[model samples]
Target: MIKVLIADDQEMIRSSLEIILSCEDDLDVKGVAKNGVEVLEFLEREPIDIILMDIRMPVMDGVLCTKKVKKRWPQTKVIILTTFDDDDFVFSALQYGASGYLLKAGDLDTLHHAIQTVYSGGAMINPGIARKVVDLFSQRQNTPIIQVEEESVNSLSELEWDVVYEIGHGFSNKEIAKNLYLSEGTVRNYLSRILSKLHLRDRTQVAIWAVENGYIGRRS
Candidate 1:
């Protein structure tokens, strides 16, 4: 089962999510926290696979909490659960290593799917916020690459290079697998290896590196 921790300041929201998620056989509610402080406390004491974190909170906000969690436990995945889709929050959360973003009002199924997607090593942007993420990245096209290390360029295998090239062109894993004539598992394994080899944090970083290094052109 996928263990999850829900962190939100509101009592009702936390209770409601706990109920909705408890029904899924593959998911289990590990714990609930009212704010980021409590989240950190819980993390100190429990073993959690994923976190559904709220953006705005009392003692600490989700973005800060996410950064701390990532620093301390890099394997624990986090998905932002927020009522607002503010561009600043979305971008900040992503930069801080949140694997997914979901609106608080998202349906149960969407929330569940986001959890599963992030847990499986894929990024998830709520459909409503996806356009904003795309627009934000598009604007960064003109930004110069000031930090590409030789290590980053040397770490990818030829097959992984092909995968990153396709990903840089905005192809999903399923699409990349189809084009490469590889199974989905093979594609995912390649990606995981690529991330490790390149010393990258996530797919977004890989995409950025590909574009910045001219491995794939911005419009490719």
Candidate 2:
């Protein structure tokens, strides 16, 4: 079963999500936390497969908690589930290693799919949130790549540039394969090469680097 822990300040939302997830045989509502502090405490007792994190909380926020969790338990995945969709929160959460960014307003099916997607090692993003991230970086596409070394950009091949552009726009591996007319396996291999060439840790860093370097919102 996909073990999940709900971390929301509101008791109603926590319990409501618990109830909703409990119905799925493939999913289990492992626990619930009212805030990030409680979420960490619960984690100390036992590891959960995923965390349905809330952005805003009293003792600690989800973004900080996500960073901590990834640091302490890199195996566990985190999906930010919040009512607010601020651009800062979206970027911060992803930058801090959040596997997914979803709005609480999404339907139950969508939430379940997101949890499953992340559990299966794929990132998920709400359409609205994705648009915001794309827009945030798209505006800076013309800002020029000053900080990144000139040789680093030249290291990638033409095909790798195609992968980088898709990643910068937050497209999934499966989506990128279809978009670029390549198999998923081929895309994954290209991503691995791109990460090594760019000295990025993972796809998230690649996405960030691509945006910062004005790789997105432009043709190859």
Candidate 3:
């Protein structure tokens, strides 16, 4: 089972998410926290597989919390629970190694799937949020372009390169699998190998690298 922690300041949201997530057989709702501080405290006592974290909180915000979580507990995946108004915070969390970005308006199925996806070593981005993130990333003039050599790029096998291009387009593992006519498990394996071969930390970095190196094309 994938162990999960719900982090939100609102009592209703935390309770609702805990109840909804507890219904899934594959998901185990380990605990709930009211803020980032509580989240870190929970981690001190036990290890968790994923955290459904709210972007805004009282003491420490989700972005800062995500950075600390990644730094101290690299294996614990975090899925930012955000709204459309939290564009800047969302991007900041992604930069700090968050594995997923999900809207509070998302359905139960989406939430459950996001946890599973992240736990399985894949990244998930809500489509609407993804488009905005891509646009925002492209607009940053100070973002340094990553220069990947042809030889380095060619080191990835053809199938792995296909996975990289799909990730660059911000396609999730499920979508990439359907488009590439491969199973989701295969896509996940390819993504793992791609990150290892490219010396990247996560798929978010891969997406940014792909855009910087011209591997990704404009999406409409």
Ranking by lDDT: 3, 2, 1
lDDT of 1 by residue, 42-116 (tens): 989988999999999988999999999999988999999876547677666777788887888878887887788
User: Largest lDDT belongs to which candidate?
Assistant: 3
Write down the lDDT that model 2 would get: 0.84
lDDT score, residue 5, model 2?
Answer: 95
What ranges in model 2 sit over 4 Å off? Answer: 138-149
> Candidate 1: where is the Cα deviation over 4 Å?
140-147, 150-162, 165-175, 207-220
Winning model by TM-score = 3
> After aligning candidate 1 to the native by TM-score, how far in Å is the CA of 158 from where it should be?
7.4
- How many clashes (backbone N, Cα, C below 3 Å) per candidate? 0, 0, 0
TM-score quality measure for candidate 3 = 0.88
TM-score of every prediction relative to native: 0.81, 0.87, 0.88
Which runs of model 3 end up more than 4 angstroms from their true locations? 145-151, 154-158, 182-189, 212-214, 218-220
Each model's lDDT comes to: 0.80, 0.84, 0.86
**What lDDT score goes with residue 165 in model 1?**
85
Q: Over the stretch 1-220, how does candidate 2's per-residue lDDT look in tens digits?
A: 9989999999899989999899999998989998999999999999899999999888999999998999999999999987654666766778778888888889999999888878876778787877677677667676532235568779989999999899878788889999999999999999989877877656766777777666786666
Query: Once model 2 is optimally superposed onto the true structure by TM-score, how far is the C-alpha of residue 104 displaced, in angstroms?
Result: 1.1
